[model samples]
Target: MRLFLCEKPSQARDIAKALGVRGKGEGCLTGAGVTVTWCIGHLLETAPPDAYDPRYKQWRLEHLPIVPEQWRMQVKPKTASQFKAVKRLLGQASEVVIATDADREGEMIARELLDHCRYRGPIQRLWLSALDDASIQKALAALRPGASTFSLYHCALGRSRADWLIGMNLSRLFTLLGQRSGYQGVLPVGRVQTPTLRLVVDRDRSIEAFQPVAWWGIDVKLEAARQVFIAQWQAPKAACDEEGRCLQQPIAEAAKAKMASAPSAQVTDVRTERMKETAPLPFDLGTLQQLCSRKFGLGAQETLDIAQALYETYKAITYPRSDCGYLPMSQHAEAPAVLAGLKRADPALVPLFDHINPGRRSRAWNDAKVSAHHGIIPTTVAPNLDKLPPRHRQVYTLIRARYLAQFLLEHSYDRTRATFECAGETLLATGKQVIEPGWKRALPEALAAQPGREPAQPLPPLARRDQCPVRDVQLKNNWTQPPKPFTEGDLISAMKNVARLVEDPKLKQKLKETTGIGTEATRAGIIQGLLDRGYLTKAGKALAATPAGCSLVDAVPRAITDPGTTAIWEQALDMVQSGEMPLEEFLARQSAWMSKLVERCKGLNVTIEGQAKAPAWKKKRKPAGARRAPAGKGRKRTAPAE
Candidate 1:
């Protein structure tokens, strides 16, 4: 018998259905000598500090660094029964195939379960980009030996261990300090969460320190062919000319002299060009969250929850947490069928599908750009729209529309710019007129509803040297604005390896080579942790880090606070996976770093007031079954409390 282990129950069901398994039993489905079983989230979690030593159960400054000699895995209490059942099934099977999601975390989920269950058998890996039956079938037919995923396991293990080392140690350390300071809850901190909080805090500080500066600009209005044209005097030129001339002073002198001079303004130059706006790349988790937050006013967590529900419950969309924004080359053949289904389900989207060429060329569709899994998109199966909730219906529609839009003809527009001279000063104006709406027709509402505020309108078209009448002219006052606080949308964008935005070019190039601060699958959770710990708070869409969060960052060592640290580690991990670097070397470096951190924190002072005190001395208790009755009390037998 062969056993197929999937990451979740929904996935197991899909695999079983594809394999023609119709019978379901305890924790598994069986048919044709193949048994399919699933794990819920995590079957085994890293053992707690108490598991290493009973004394470590209570939070105490004296027990600051709880480093285990060797990390142990314990079955999660809620999933122990399922774990045991899967373990037994794996032992009986002749071969096992891992049918988890094709991503790093998914790889970890399967590998850890196998390691914890002590399963020894021929293992095969089923890797696919989508959940559709066709993709699954192809993956199954082309299964490779599990040894191919060994580096994935190493990367996963390294990630898990690094997170564990940082999270467990820092959470406990901070919790003890909080308790000592009379705070009631754990001061949660983690490798990813802390940096995310710092980002918010830093943004808030920038906003707070900003002082707006007032400046004035000259606006010239010109009338041409019964239409009014507007242009701004290039502020720097208006302030001073090539001969150190001040045009503003000259204008003021003209008013003082009462010399009504109708400045003859002419269009000095005109430039026109056709520009194409290609469809946006498909939705990765981060990009999807950003769009929903910026466009639909949805929170990051809310967007993720809705996307996950659509993917897992409705089965209308592909995997939601993927980072790749391109489809696999093989999926190109099914584009038409997927579009046909979308049109059938949402007839409103028909017009957008008319120009779709499955072979459309765009940087967004390159096969070489993908990693782990392809972008989130609609499956080939016709969606039962009625089965999904209203919000999920909206999310699914967005996903489908985006996928269809990708194959459609690119949006085309005519961009025009006009240069004008007034009062011996040059003014500039520009406009973009849509020549072909193309895919943009699908989401007109999304385009119309500009949430925050309306920006100034574009200038009207004009020919070179054409004379026009100025209806009105007014000087406008403007203020230089400070950097805005990080909206959840902005933070999501910043977190996607934006080291290029930093001033240092070397750092930017290094970060580009490594995957960003956190993987797409884990970034949202890391953000949520910051909120739960009171390290950050949401004011509207903007994130503001709390004083405690700022202090925590100040307290931590420089190496840990820097995002480049994670980037460097990611580069090494990638090398390990590519067979260019040894996993042992990475582990050794991590061990050495961990030791240094432990030694540094050992002598650090943390003060908490009016909280539960740690016990100074430990007492040994008898074995569970060998408890004795108190001597002074009645000889009556006492039972253990339930």
Candidate 2:
């Protein structure tokens, strides 16, 4: 019998329905000599440090770098029963089909199990982008040989082992070091988590060290035919900062006084240009998470969870773990069906139906720009809007709006910039008049506001040399503000575009080529892990590093905490995925680097000054005059001589 293996039960059910597999078994469905079974994520996981040797369990400096000669994986106890069911089916089958998520991690999940179970059969891969019946049927006609994706497994394995080496060894090394300093807390670290934590820690440091600089500005109100508009005084180049902020208070004050005393102002120049704004590309997981965090106050992980439900549960949208916001050219052909489903999904979309052109093509459709998966979009299957929870409906609406935007015309406007001379001071005013709302009309005005923009006020028409009365002039004082603390949305955006933050020119370009610090699927989890470990805390919507997080970043080596290091690893992993670098070679280099790190940290003499106090649950007050207990006999040995 031919067997189908899937990543989750929901995925299996969708595939089974498409293939007409109606008979239900213990952990699978069966019909017409075909069997479908599923894994609850991964049936097998890499063995922990203690699995190699019991002595490794005791945290000691000597056993810092634990590298196994031969890596091993064992069945996860929680999902052992499902593993048995799959193994039995594998034993009886002559052919097996891999029907899991289309990504590196999914490849590893299936390939690792087949290797462990010793399944020696012809294997085929079903690369489905969506769990909808039509998508499944389409994918069924084009199954790739399992060998075609075998390299992805190696790529993923290399990443997993490298993360393990760093996390298991470095985490132990730092925890032991913290214990020696009279702080009894586990200092957990990882390849991605460490660098991610450092980002917040460094930002906090910058904010703390920031000294606000005072600046001044003057605004002049000019009136023409009963219409009033404000014009900002432009300081001379020699008296202004690089950003054109008037830093010389005397010049600003003089300009304010001169403008106030002036009887009239002459319009020096008025330039108007028509501009067009293309709609934003559709949602990739990172972009979607960032938008949800900003608009709905949802955390990164929370956004991913909601998007995942829309994909797997309701079949309302396509895959949510996509990295590219560009759609494949081939997918453009299905826009009519998806558009029809969207109209049926919500009545609020009735007005937009007249504007959407089924054949219209936007810049978003490009085969070359598409990555592992295309952008997250609506499926041809329409979901019942009334049945969806509020959060789900809100997120679905945002995703649908972006897709609808592709069929509409570009937003067009006329931008007008006016320059005036008043009392020997040069003043500037700008305004925009919309010629066509176009794609912007598909979204609410609040949602369509550009990032970091305030509402613009429309201006009255003006001539190049027309004169106007000077109504009012006011001097305003402002201070340069420090960088704001990250919200989950801000953090997601930073991770996605981390190249902007790197100081080194070469490394910055490399990060840009390789995308960013973490994969779209894993970044949310990394941020969540930091919060669960108390390395980060939430204050309203802003994210802050706890004292422990700051202390750990201070104690760790710069090389490990640098975002550049993670970017380098990502480049190497990409090479592995493309077969440019062998899997064994990558692991060997990682093992050597980890060994040297452990050795270097062992001899280092450092103290964690101002360590964060233990959490209240772990804090206890002893009787007065009672001495604190020593950590252990090994504490003195672990500490270096001052």
Cα TM-score of candidate 1: 0.87
Candidate 1 residue pairs that clash: 180-608, 180-609, 181-608, 181-609
Model 2, position 35, has a per-residue lDDT of 93
lDDT of 2 by residue, 1-642 (tens): 989999999999999999999999988999999999998887887776677888865778887688888999888798899999998888988999999889988888888889999998899999988989989999999999999998889988888778778877777788778777776556666766778888898888999999998899888889986899888889999987788888889888888888899998899999999999998899999999888888889988889889999999999899999988999998998998999888877788888888889899999999999988999999998888889999998899899889999999999999989999998889999888999999998886669887798666677889988898998888999999999999998898888788887898888988887677877887887777677657889988899998888888887898888888887887798899889999898999999998998999986554554444333433465421121111111100110100
lDDT of each: 0.69, 0.83
Residue 446 displacement (Å), model 1: 1.7
Compose the digit string of candidate 1's lDDT tens values, residues 341-419: 7778766666665666767655666778887778998987757778777777777777776786777677788787888
Indicate the TM-score of model 2. Answer: 0.94
How far out, in Å, is residue 144 in model 1?
2.2
Give me the runs in candidate 1 sitting further than 4 Å from their true place.
61-64, 177-184, 237-264, 359-361, 384-387, 448-461, 501-507, 602-642
